[model samples]
Target: EPEVTQTPSHQVTQMGQEVILRCVPISNHLYFYWYRQILGQKVEFLVSFYNNEISEKSEIFDDQFSVERPDGSNFTLKIRSTKLEDSAMYFCASSVGTPKQYFGPGTRLTVT
Candidate 1:
């Protein structure tokens, strides 16, 4: 089976800077999601997209964050400003209309 893939496996940025994380989900999957796990915390949902629009988003996905499907095969997450608290491992996932989701190796974001 195909899998989700993320770029820049590790990212480091200064506080208040902007960053964009990229992901390429399974080609045939129609549902896409972004999740994050702080250093040792549980995986938390950030947002879900389907049919070219945001289907659901969590409070953690505040105004500073955005998701986009810039083309047929790529999905992205943009953080307008980085905060120390935002440092975490961000993961991209996809599913075929089910509860099971395939996850990508996360991109670790470190804010200083």
Candidate 2:
């Protein structure tokens, strides 16, 4: 079975450093998305990229965030200037569209 893979299941970073979270989406999928869940919050969509451009995005994706498909098999999310509020579990998902999406185990980002 195909699955989305995210690296560094746990990340601890300072208050003002850049961090690049990496993910490998399922092969043959047409849509990829980045979502986050704050400790007691619901899963929120950050951004969705397909055909090399953003398809949909949520208010949470601010200027501090950027996403890229650096190569054939890698998808990355970069956060500039981390903040304490940024601590959350970031999930990477890939799907053909709106039916079902496969999510990565998640990278728990902890900022101090």
How much lDDT does each candidate structure score? Answer: 0.97, 0.94
TM-score of each: 0.98, 0.96
Candidate 1 residue 20 C-alpha distance from true site, Å: 0.5
Worst lDDT window (10 residues) for model 1? 1-10
Query: In model 1, which regions exceed 4 Å deviation?
Result: none
Deviation of model 1 at 98, angstroms:
0.8
User: Number of the top candidate by TM-score?
Assistant: 1
Candidate 2 residue-wise lDDT at 71: 93
lDDT of 1 by residue, 1-112 (tens): 6889999899999999999999999999999999999998999999999999999999999999999999999999999999999999999999988999999999999999
Span of ten consecutive residues with least summed lDDT in model 2? 92-101
Clashing pairs in 2: none
Clashes of each: 0, 0
